[model samples]
Target: MKVKHITIIGLGLIGGSLGLALKKQCGEALKVTGVDHDQETLELAVQRGAVDYSTNDWKRGVEQADIIFLCTPVLQIIPIVEQILPYVKVGGILTDVGSTKGFLAEKLLYMMPSGVHYVSGHPMTGIERSGIMAADRGLFKDKWYILIPEASTSPEAVEIISQTLTWTGARITTMDLYDHDQCAAIISHIPHVVAAALVNLLGKYPALEESFKLVGGGFRDTTRIASSNADMWADICLTNSQPITQSLLQLKELLDEMIQAVEKADRPAIHHFFKRAKVRRDILIEETDSHVV
Candidate 1:
């Protein structure tokens, strides 16, 4: 399917950045429209050249769109899609940048209108900051963007979406719904939880102010993601509960091992634990850095 007109719902960081990148790369070939509830955000998106036009009306925004991107929070995506499905042009494609995919794929696969297609996507890139003001056209550059297409989805639709996303400078790959959610739980969801937990733990201290005074790069770097949007993180945790819980339990086990070693003053065990972590983390960083463009 040849994409010409595109509609992006939710003019926040991901949506705004995507609009900017698409506009910059596709130029006059693609007519990008941005939709947000906030009129100020719509105006800002237009001013930033993120889209050709902007609107607060979902129906009007999607009327002429060939591809509609749902960039809202996980829970809001389905409702927004449901509202706009009737307005979506026949043969149009719909996709998302949500964090979780299993539930989305299960529901959206059957929810799409007969001629319209739904493809689940998650871009594995973002910072703690959000909103249109923080959006950068290069946010997705050199990052992994996973596409989850159901068996019912057409190859033409997937190819069209992939080609469009490629213009953002992302490395595109495909994954099944189950695998995508499971891996995301490990890499993204649980890490956010851990970061929040670390910050909360610090907050619980009796001498919190004093302790904060001694904060260094280690604490800042580790807990940077804790500053991410709480509503979005809450939705992610609720939607992907099982995977997140399982990962958290496994993490608890590791923490228990360390706690026991400390309690018993097991020097060798402590040394072994740190050494093993250092080795694995070093290897992981080395492998990841090798892939950077």
Candidate 2:
């Protein structure tokens, strides 16, 4: 599976990282062309050898590539895919790195051009850091990439994308787009929301300063996601609110249970919760070597 010319839109952390990875891992057979709204990012991408060329013009980038990775946020992919449909060549593979997939998958199918290939992809890996400076060439190494293929999607297209992604040290996993969104909502989206809320709550309680001083590794890890880009997180909540809401409700139930147990002095129940949580965390660590579970 060879990609001669690839276009990466946005060229932020995800896009820029992809370009860097592809160029390093598959550079001999690929020419990455980055399209970013920012001039500095474009220049950095070129300097870092992430792309052979960089442009802000969508038409120029789309017309010359065999594959396109829409690295834009979840909410933005729909309109960009719509506008790009007309410009993209007949056989080009169009995929995205959006977190939510249900709405994106449906919208792409609805507006996709006759000859264009659309595959919904979610790279289940990222950092709290932002921009090209924070972009690492090894970001996707040993990570999980979910490929959501539609009924109309070409097998050859799927194979090509899967193989190309694998070249970047990522393993490909396939699942229903809706199922993907549901899982992401629970494990990813809900956690981000809770983290941000935790940080906000800390801000509101000045009296908690003494207690908060003991905030250590666990607290840092739990609240790390709160530092992610607000605009991007907001978009994920908007596009995938259904699953996110469900996740939130489930989480609230669990939290309420814990609160009630503590209030009623149910020591046994509280101990049971911690015991189960520890087991779950241990199992999660065992699966850490996987790209995306």
Candidate 3:
């Protein structure tokens, strides 16, 4: 089962880059079409050779494609899914590149038209920037793509989609949607809140902000993705607010305990906490570096 007619909705950074990747991988076997809300971006995608055809109309393009990729923002995904559900071709493979998954995917499932095969996916890679010009063809290469396919999804559909992703140089992994969302709360969403807080801290103290001039690679790296689309990030936090709040509280508790330990001159308590954390952090860094290399 080869994918021929493909329509990618949203010609933003991810969508445009995906169109190019699919063309490079599938060659003539795949015919890529892109639908974008912005006419300028849609035309840019076509000019860049990312898509064979581009349009702003969802009804005309989405309904007939054999494979459709939803690359829009997280919050708008559900409504967009519902609006285009009727147009999705029978047996069409549906997928999305969204950060938060569980709640959104489930909503789409109940609302999606019958006979359409949908598999949820998130490529755990991207920079702080976005838009058509910021598109990178190798963005997903050597990165992890978490695919959450529902029980109703066919094994054949999963296989074909997995193969397509492998062509983009991404490693495929599967997880339950709930677990994925919870995991993202700690690793993804919590960090954005922290960075946004850190930047706000710098903003509050302009005089002391000269200290930012002394900031090194670690600070820059830590806050790099903090510069992403604010509206999109707001949606991510709001969509998974409960888990993010829980993580934030847990972090607050840890810091409070550390402060108490420092006030009491509890050196051993501080040492124990830092030691455990460093060990785990090192393991994660090593694992990520190993995979990337």
Candidate 4:
């Protein structure tokens, strides 16, 4: 079925971008409604042409929506789902742009009404920034938008979500909920923690603060993600604690091995470590280039 009315909650970067993308792709065929608790954000989203209509009243925004996109923080998605479940139309599909999906998939599948559907999703795109002003119509273009559907998720819901997101030029990936979380913990969640920890390490050396001014592109590039929304990351880390923690433990083991190699002046072992990492990194670059072509 064609989606006519789409309600997007949270009106932040992802939500606003989805609004702009829908407008750009579907034009007058689809009506985009944006809901946010912040009035300034609603105004900014309207000014950016990212939304056709703006509302603070979520119930009103979702009442007649054919599809609902919860673009809130990882933890907020399910709560919003619960709040809108009563107003969501029968057979309507509800999805999220949350980073972690295992718990969300479980809870949403249980809470979704008999006729309604919920599919947990995560878009592997964004900047080191936030807010409506940072919204980009092309943010999701050529990016991976993952859909983690539980056993209860309907095929119709998956198709609807895939079709809607396809307009944004995203390459859709379908995976089971558990596998999705495990992958995210390694590639996304743990990287954020590593970035933050690196930046925080600088805080411990007040005497070397002056030396930091000399740090250039490498430091900035490595820590760019550390500037992302803290509260949002906090929620993701907590919700997906199990996998993130496991990944960190594995990372710590690697770091310990590197430290031992350095202390023992094991040049051969250190060289092998760096060489192995470089080989893996080059392989990733080659694979990415192949995919782009």
How well does each candidate superpose onto the true structure, as a TM-score? 0.97, 0.95, 0.94, 0.98
lDDT (Cα, tens digit) per residue for candidate 2, span 1-293 = 35788999988889888988988987667888898888998999899888889988889988978899999877888778767777898789899999988878887867777777888899988999888888888899878888998787788889989988987788788988778999999889999999999989998989888898889999899999999999899999999988999889999999999999999999999999999999999889877745243
Instruction: List, residue by residue over 1-293, the lDDT tens digit for candidate 1.
Output: 67889999999999999999999999999999999999899999999999999999988899999999999889998888888998998999999999998878888888987899888899999999999998899999999999988788888899999999999999999998888898999999989999999988876777667758788899999999999999999989989999999999999999999999999999999999999999999999999889987
Q: How does residue 150 of candidate 3 score in lDDT? A: 78
lDDT of 3: 0.85
Pairs with backbone N, CA or C atoms under 3 Å apart (clashes), candidate 1: none
lDDT of 4 by residue, 212-240 (tens): 99989999999999999998999999999
Flag the better candidate by TM-score, 2 or 3: 2
The 0-to-1 C-alpha lDDT of every candidate, in the order given, reads 0.92, 0.87, 0.85, 0.89
Give candidate 3's error at residue 271 in angstroms: 2.6
Please identify model 2 stretches exceeding 4 Å from their true place. 207-214, 288-293
lDDT of 4 at 269: 89
lDDT of 1: 0.92
Please give the RMSD of candidate 4 to the true structure.
1.0
Q: 3 or 4: which has the higher lDDT?
A: 4
- Model 1: residues with Cα > 4 Å off, grouped in runs: none
Instruction: Give every collision pair in model 2.
Output: 143-291, 144-291
**Model with the higher lDDT, candidate 1 or 2:** 1
The top-ranked prediction according to lDDT is 1
